[model samples]
Target chain A: MDFLGDYTLRIVALGAGTLGIVAGALGAFAVLRRQSLLGDAISHAALPGVVLAFVLTGTKAPLGLLLGAAFAGWAATLAVMAIARMSRIKYDAALGIVLSVFFGIGLLLLTDVQKQPDATQAGLDRFLFGQAAGLLRSDVITMMALGLPVLVALALLWKEFKLLAFDPGFGASLGLPMRALDVVLTGLLVVAIVVGLQTVGVVLMSAMVVAPAAAARQWTDRLGTMVVLSAGFGALAGVVGAVISSRVERMPAGPTIVLCVTVLVLVSLFLAPRRGLLWARVRARRARARLRVQAVLEALLDLDARHGDGHAHSEAVLEVAGAGRGGAGRTLAELERRGWAERRGDDAWLLTPAGRAEAEERYGGRR
Target chain B: MTGVQLEIQAIAAVTAAACALPGAFLVLRRLSLLSDAIGHSILLGIVLAFLVVQELTSPFLVVGAALVGLLTVVAVELVRGTGLVREDAAIGLVFPALFSLGVVLVARYTDSVHLDTDAVLLGELAFTPFDRLVAGGWDLGPRALWVMSVILAVNLVALLLFYKELKLTTFDPALALALGLAPGLVHYGLMTLVSVTAVGAFTAVGAILVVALMIVPPATAYLLTDRLGVLLGASVGIGVASAIGGYWLAHALDASIAGSMAATAGALFALAFLFAPGRGLVAAARRRARQRWEFPQTMLAIHLLNHEGLPEAAVENRIDHLDAHLGWEPAFAREVVERAQRRGLVRSDGAALELTDRGRAGARSSLARTA
Candidate 1:
């Protein structure tokens, strides 16, 4: 109870939850555009910007670091685009190249910064991987302030984004500024990523962007529903991770948050009603069972049709049906229970009127 | 060694080798971002290896990293199989979580770990040789070169052994499956190789440079050739060239070596995109312009052939038709006619312009080819 009552825990949870909503909203489109990796690339790329900003300003202020991150993220995006457009290299490869180069530069810059004699540089390392435990009230407020407008903007452009995602060519043909929309969407992703980095860090921020959207996609097909659900899932993971980490003496916030997101993704993969693995398996099983029952009924009908009014023995029918004597007896019992068959004498069974009608209807009125 | 001269050679070789092998597969598979994912996810492998061995220089580190890289592929595949998340989204979901886990572990266990999340995520290719591998008192500073060589060998052998299978599967996976080839096995095998290559290169070159190595060379090669075999060889060549070039550039500027390598690769790709024959931007533009110039002349010939009703007589009026299409500019039309005649497709018959049988055939063939 005391753990829950802690002000720091409450603040972290609130901040993470807000960031999650923003990330979830942006991630839905990022996933749809197949630019999920872009999130990872940009987040990692932002490191150099953070270090550079610190070098220039000589301060580890949130605003300066964020501005630096945004610049780096945008620059990485541009580099990716330039590589893709200028070379025969595909978009993914370009993204890979840009992500690696930018991040490497950032790492080198940070190493240089760390060598400097500054106490503020002491905790700057946390931003590299993320240390959500160190999040302050001002940080939380900053996240919410930045996150809310981005989420609201996404909401406003939800329909446009959906159309753009589903078919950009058609969207362009219909006079939509697909390029503008793309920029807007990419901008939103960058903002969400930069802000989320505070909570999840560069290494894991990509997961936060992708996991909730992926989980929500399992439960719904509609874009609006997916976005809403994804946001909900993200917030839930955020709150849960924050709470759990706060309870533990030494657990950091970022990994716990990511773990929570991972759990949600796994659950969605296995248990979602319409598209989950378990549901698909159950559907397949039911389909197979129905096919077996139908096959048995078809065989019985064929036997009746062949024998006409002569009433062939059940043993002969079982042989024709490719069932063993024991198997035949079990099928007979099942048919009798369903009122589809009746024992006529010592070794024969007859199809009832309803059974005959069912067989005929099911097998295209076959004998 | 002078920093500039030494750094250039080191960066160039590492960058070139890194990009060449993976870039080919990335282009073929169309999962270019897989490189990005592998780059980030390998951090987890490194961290995990560090934890188990408690030493950064353990041979087990490479193995552990390779295992983690393979784990990332499995995780991505598993996520993809869910069908809820698309392929890129699945990649996005898996690598970050693993990377985060790596970061958290590092933070918890290590004291002010210099290999931070960004460093792990991006790589340290520029400073790679600074960390030397001393085996039996031998000085092997460029450890990445050896690791990459082995990985490259594996990649080349696998590609050669399964050339036909890989080509068929890459061009048309469903068709390959229908023909009784298990695409799943090939896919898993390729992914495993990618993982091993990525992890092996990570320590020597750094993460981001590995990406540059994996993607840029193949892309440049793609621009220069249409044949798959040639493309692979060329990509590797381009990668190596860029690595060497970028290393030198970085040393010259005192900049990040990995960044310089990537920039070099990017510049190579840009050059190829602009100047390569057939598919190059300049070539394509030239082709388009030539097509526009010849179109009206071809159209005029077709019109004259339709009007004259005699294939032989059509040759005499070919220039007149060309003139008519351009509003009867005699000098230009005559030039066009002479050019067409020189190609053995037109003939002069006194004042009337006409086409030869060969000319008619040539016109038809050109039209068909364009269409």
Candidate 2:
């Protein structure tokens, strides 16, 4: 409770919240455009940029470093696109190439920086896995400055961005510069990614981009609503994760935030209304139940039609219909409960008038 | 290089080449991201297995890590199968979460000394030679070389055993399925091999850059060749070359060796992208440049041959009329005529153009090509 009113906690929370909102919103487009892995490649590519900025500038300004990260990430994505377009390399392979290669070069450079005789570079590798506790008020403001423009750009070109995400080919056909738009959109993504990199690090930053949007996608089909919900999920998870990590020693906020959002993803994946796993299972069960009931009713109707005057069948109906599994008796019971079948004797069954009509309609279609 | 240095390079080269074998198939199948996903997430497997075995050198740890690699693939497929997310999104969702769990576990439960998380991401290939595989107190070799040598052998055996199935499933999954080759089974098998290779290569390249070895060389090979056999062989060759080249680059710079190898592979890919003979960007651009002049000159020769001594021969064959009749930009037409004349394909007589004997032969051949 002592940490509740702490000012530093609030600032870190705000920084993480800003990260979530920007990354989540941009990530919605990335996921929809099937460029979810692009975020991973971009983040990995940002490492060299962050290190290079420090090596060149002899200063570690968050804004300048993020700009370098954005530039490097954007350039890497362009390389990925070029590799995919120019050669027989698949887009995924191209992405892997850039991701690994850029990170490798970054590592190579990071070590080179560390070896400098006058180098007092203490925490440059912190960007690799973020040093979240190092978040300053300026860092928070830097995130806002970087993130807010992307949001404003998103607002200004809502229709074009939507077209860019959903149907770039159609947008291009409509005389839009779809390729240029894609480049700009990717630039925006790189900015959003660098905004989060300070809080989430390179590897986990991609999870920040992808997880919230993926979770939100399970809850909505509309783009605007999905983006809003994704932002909410990201921000909620970010604050909670930052606070939890601050409370627990040795717990970094980036992975905590990643795991927290992962929990939301799993919850959404399994429990969201229309698209969730639970609903799918329920729908499957309902369909299976309906099929079994129909089969039993048809069996009863077939007996009536063959024996004349609603002739009855015994418990053998369940056997004949092959419904004798988990709900073997329940299928017949369900029919009787629906007043579609009735008990003729202790062990016999007969089709009701409603059941006969129901069976006839379905059975007629089959015939 | 001393014996130790040579051993290090041998391990690096073997690891690189072994990874390349599966790398070739992964690239061909267009599921190269699986390598990235598996590489990161297998850290959890190694860590969890290490907790149980308590011995870093235990073979069960390798098996456990490989199994976790398979689990990562299974988890991605399961998530993607739900239709809630696409494959890439599923990949993005699954690996980081699992990897983060691994990081958290390592951070919380384990000491940093044994399983340093930094070593997991950027492995210390420099220290790999120190961990010798001693038998009866005799130094057999570096443990990494033995691990990677077995993996290279496994990959080679797998490649030879399932080359047909892999090729069939890669280029034509529908036919592979119809032929009852069980492309799905082959896919899982390929994934298993990938997971195993990632585990074997994990100690040398670390979790992140194993993807570099597993994906980059084959991807570079893909640019150089179109045939699967050639692609696989080229991947191995390129991967080994990167390993050897990277060892020296690191030697020169005092940087991370694994990182250097990945960087070297990346540089190789960049080279192949620009200059691979048939399919490279430079090659294609050069081809276009050659055709720019060559194609139009052939057309000019054909045009001249068509109107030799005819009533419209002067009008049609005149260099001045080329812009209007042939729809050239006047400048382009003059350039074309000049190029043709320079090549002895046509001669200019006053304002009329005449085909030379060589020009007639060239025009006839052009016509024959069209036929």
Candidate 3:
């Protein structure tokens, strides 16, 4: 109720929501291409572009800054590719080189800007970690204008992108222009990152790009579903993180938004119905229990075949049916608890008639 | 340079060299970007350590920060073990979350007054000369110099002591493990040193420069040489040079010293990328050009040999018909003929071309190699 009534909450929500949708949709491709860290590289590389734009234009207009950032981000990607292709240096190392160097240049320009006796550099630091409370309607409008095209492009080339992300070799076989598609996709990623930088900042913008997509992936296998779900999760994190940070004292919106998406990712990892850690653990436990029960029952049947049902079987002898000593011991104890087998002496078990029938029914064909 | 300027340069140089040492291994391992992760996450480590010790200059802070840095690596590894997400995604997921937590901690508790966030992100190397380390009232120069010197010593000592193990593990971890080198221990040990170096340098260079210093120089050196020993030496040399060069650039522009240092490192890497004699872009292009000329000549020689004294030779050997016969552009066919003629690999008579004995021999050798 409080969030609904608040005007700042609404603005933060709209701005962060737009950012989330754009970032989440683009991030799916990045994550799929194993370029998940590209977001981090591009965002860091953008700092120089932002600073250069300010110095070149003599103004900190978002449009000029965004253009500069896009250029720098694109150059960084190209540099990374060039370094990887031209030398033995791997892509990851190239990424590091580009990220740090570009950021370093940016820092130099930024500090130089601070040396001048001016007020323009006042909010420049906000680009590092972002200050969502400062977002104006114009910034939000600019984000929508930029974000809409990215989404439109993504829609226009959905099949090509899917093919490129999943199987570029096959896409090439299909006579698809993969290189052009790659450039266009990376271009979209650059745009998404630039738009979000003002709100989430450079340091935390990568999380907006990666976390939502990562979370969405855990929930589905279909690319289309993953994209839609990622966009939804991103929007949800955006609105929730923005609203909470706006209400809380000393809570920065950028980090808060990142943390909110992280929470979603963790929840999906551990608690989602079928793919979750909890479910996997439960399934594994059930499988183990089934195996142990089968082994004990089979061992009991072996004893019946040799010396009749009442004959006690040694723990070591029963282990031949399957599993370790501790496992067989536990299986025997479990059988007795279920009234499937009766303990005859120390370290021994005898199968009940009912247990013999059950084992026969389940593992009869296997033997 | 002035005395203060010299001190600043010394600090920056030592810091870069220290980062470059462990960075070589990271680049080789293809985990160079992990240094960036460690660099940012270490801020959280520093802030948490500061909260506990309540002293900015406490040794416990370094230990706490180093431990937290190690924790970042371990956390990344743990997430990677899930097999659901990729290594880069895991790295992307872990560092930002940890870094954001650190940011939130700094923002909420300190109000950013006690610990200037700007200094942490873009370190004030120019101010390094002011933070003098005094022991018992005796001035010990700049604190950054002392701290970075200690880190450098640690890096050098560790590198010297574990040279063989590090080499084996880096080049072939499975072989190192077979020889009882404990590759896992070496990996964690190297990670610890990386974190220690990064944390120590954080005060002088900030997170961005520290990451740049760690990765860029090593990568540049990798482009120049293939020898491990030379890589190490060149990386350290490049790191120091970038530091000095960056300082001067900052002086000329009157900008952030740490930032200029990072830019210098990037510039040096770009230079190596384009100009390194053995593995540079230009050299590679030249090599490609040579292969292109030689390959077409070989194909022409082979074609001539295949159709020698045959009726098809009259039509196939002609320069105009070769384009359609071999699917080459007409200009390319003429260029190939001209090149082959210059090399004496082929004789162009009026309207026909024939491979010489030398051309046939060259074709045979090349074809043998391919086969």
Docking category for candidate 1? acceptable
C-alpha lDDT (0 to 100) for residue A154 of candidate 2? 86
- With a 3 Å backbone cut-off (N, CA, C), the pairs that clash in candidate 3 are none
What value does the lDDT take at residue B331 in candidate 2? 88
Off by over 4 Å in 3: A1-5, A309-324, A327-330, A336-339, A342-349, B296-364, B367-371
* Candidate 1, B-chain TM: 0.84
Q: Each prediction's Cα RMSD?
A: 5.4, 2.5, 3.4
In candidate 2, how many Å is residue B120 off? 0.6
Consecutive 10-residue window with the lowest summed lDDT within model 1 chain A: A322-331
lDDT of 3 at B248: 96
Q: Which digits, one per residue and each the tens of the lDDT, describe model 2 over residues B285-366?
A: 9999988899889888888888888999978999888888778888898889888888888989887899999999999999
Off by over 4 Å in 1: A1-5, A48-59, A75-88, A105-127, A167-174, A308-364, B2-15, B46-56, B104-119, B122-146, B156-168, B171-184, B249-255, B274-371
Could you give candidate 1's per-residue lDDT for residues A164-268 as a string of tens digits?
899989989999999999888898889898887877787778888989998998999898899999899999999999988888755678888998998999899
DockQ of each: 0.40, 0.82, 0.80
Write model 1 residue lDDT over B1-371, tens digit each, in one string: 68535743754575466457656877767877777677767888888888888887777877888788878888888777766677888887787678767766876776545456555545666566576558999986566656666677788788889988888888899999999889889887877777788777665456656776787678778878878988888887887787777667766766666666676776777677788888888898899888865765675566555556665544435555555455758886776676766767666776566667877876777768888
Per-residue error at A198 for model 3, in Å? Answer: 1.1
- Candidate 1 chain B lowest-lDDT run of ten: B313-322
